[model samples]
Target: MTDKATAAGELTDIGNKRYFGEGLLRWYRKERRDLPWRRSRNPYHIWVSEIMLQQTRVDTVIPYFNRFVGRFPTLRHLAEAPEDDVLKHWEGLGYYSRARNLQAAAREVVEHYGGEVPRGKAEVSGLKGVGPYTTGAILSIAYDQPEPAVDGNVMRVLSRYFCLEDDIARPATRVAMESLAQSLIPEGQAADFNQALMELGAMVCTPKSPSCPVCPVGEHCEGRLQGRERELPVKTKAKKARPVFRLAALIEGTGAYAGKVLVRQRPETGLLAQMWELPHIEAPDEEIWNRLDEGAGLLEAALAEDGVRVKASNEVVGEAQHIFTHLVWKIKVLGAAALEERYVADRTGYRWIGPEEFENYAWPNVFRKLLTEYFLLVRRG
Candidate 1:
């Protein structure tokens, strides 16, 4: 078979391709969800929504998208905004790196592309956080270019329709999927077609149980016909997240600093970079970490290593967990009070802030909820 024939494969017959595209387009136009992002073809708007939608559900991203655009109405606004302000807005969204990279790419656009989202594939793809999928999404959705936005949803839909058994987790499979997706895009309908594929995957051809009976293109679905619809889009399992134990200090204020807690900003790099949280230290093991008394002593000694002294109480303030792709932080928050009065003001990345000033800093969701709850109790007393 020729290279074109091989790439096209047996499923690329003209009649089948035409039927699939037309059916998807018709179904999408009539049944598409009224998402906020679908209201415009503006590249910036589409770009932000696409980024926000990554690994996030549509219902969850709706308010965040609306608020984000409302706050940073233009690319110039996002480019010029402070990193803290951007992170503050993206506080609960998780994957904070997305917000940071979006701002960085926005700055690059303002400096190079005259503050407008560029039309060229290379230019769009060159921006920070703009991967192959995002590049295709921006180009096809905004510029109406016939690029394939083949994310998981698109991959799943294609795999089921064509009965592809290749592991969707593999990079080579994604390239093949992208090629197939691009080929299927009808002329001048790139945006709608791409969205339609995603819609079908998300709403009908779901991972657990596909709604094959009501699927728009169910008539010709190879996976369903062969009774392999549940397994066609083969994917390897990801590594389990490793668990970590740590103790955090919820130090109450004293003397000059009253009705406040001690908080610190994380280092400029690494996991949860540059975000604020209560002072904490990694425990040697879960046994020591679970023992409130030993944990308090360990927490005090750990803080002393950095020339800051805190006398920890035996009381446990709260417990929370923050899960990342690779690890899970099992944090036990303990009540404590500052022993070093001199460092209570503003020493290094540490500071004492009251409940009213919580908005001034961006905190991880786990810490935010812990501190917010603590303050509410303080207020009630």
Candidate 2:
């Protein structure tokens, strides 16, 4: 609740709180979708599912979650697996940093906690990539501890139900919401209650337009009663992603390296770290990027500056776009042929791989799609 609400004596009535909890639980038990992660009480499975579910949809994560657990069935397996193999399993799932942090945390657990997730809140929160929300989720859902797993969905639901007009994007507001959420958890029903709140938010109390009439606790929803359900839970908008233009070379190999294409691994740190992709260079402006002949020359010059020589042709091969939280890359690909055999002695990061070796390296989604299409066209030819 905001200070204004508190000062106005607009606290959640005791009756409304009781009804909200009981109504949510009853509705969840009866109408909840049967999810794979809910089938068992395994802490590892629950932790992985929570991590994967962050900023990702439930339906998209189902198959990935199943395959991930099947590949690394236990904490030790995940801790011991090679980074590349772990990355391979998580290839299509964006936000590669999540997978990296998860593996790092798994290794820490294996060594310090003896391959078991710690029950203490501090211990779980200390793991890499496990923030307050994830900590609460693992503690409550996995251990059945009375913790509040408050996320955007939970906040939206609570703000509407309680008619809170606070800006949810603020750190202080989240802390208050977390405190309120923890207080509402029913005794001995932390797991189900927390999940129920999340389910209600996801299904009924949505962001755009809430289905208030069908909501179990709609009878007492302050936002709905006040006719401000959509206006509550105020949030600030994020900055737009900045656009960048890049030129990529689809360099075909010749001589002994025939049937292969040139590729390079990204630096060990920073964006798309350690991922492989077609050789490319950022264009100074969009105009040059759109001009294939000029962009091809700039691409060759840029790669030569880095000791990677290729003869880029004016013909366009492909074009694609990849969006990140802060940046967007508008890429134009040009046909090319490798011009130097010196790369053979340079094992730095460059490689000439044929379609048979596609499975050997993980690629960013944009490049993966481009390469997949290129291979399919070649096969047809």
What's the TM-score of every candidate structure?
A: 0.95, 0.94
Model 2 whole-model lDDT (C-alpha atoms): 0.90
- lDDT, model 1: 0.92
lDDT of 1 at 131: 99
Most lDDT-accurate candidate: 1
Task: Give the winner by TM-score.
Answer: 1
Off by over 4 Å in 1: 1-12
Q: Write the residue-wise lDDT of candidate 1 on 1-381 in tens digits.
A: 898887677556777999999999999999999998899899999999999998789999999999999999999999999999999988888999999999999999999999989999999999999999999999999999999999999999999999999999999999999999999999999999999999999999999999999999999999999999998789999999999998999988878887888899999888889999999989888888878898899889988887779999878879999998899999988888888666656588888889889989999999999999998998999
lDDT of 2 at 353: 82
Shift of residue 317 alpha carbon in model 1, Å: 1.9
Q: Write the per-residue lDDT of candidate 2 for residues 33-148, one digit (tens) a residue.
A: 88999998889999999999987999999999999999999999999999888888888888899999999999999999999999999999999999999999889998999999
lDDT, candidate 2, at 381: 80
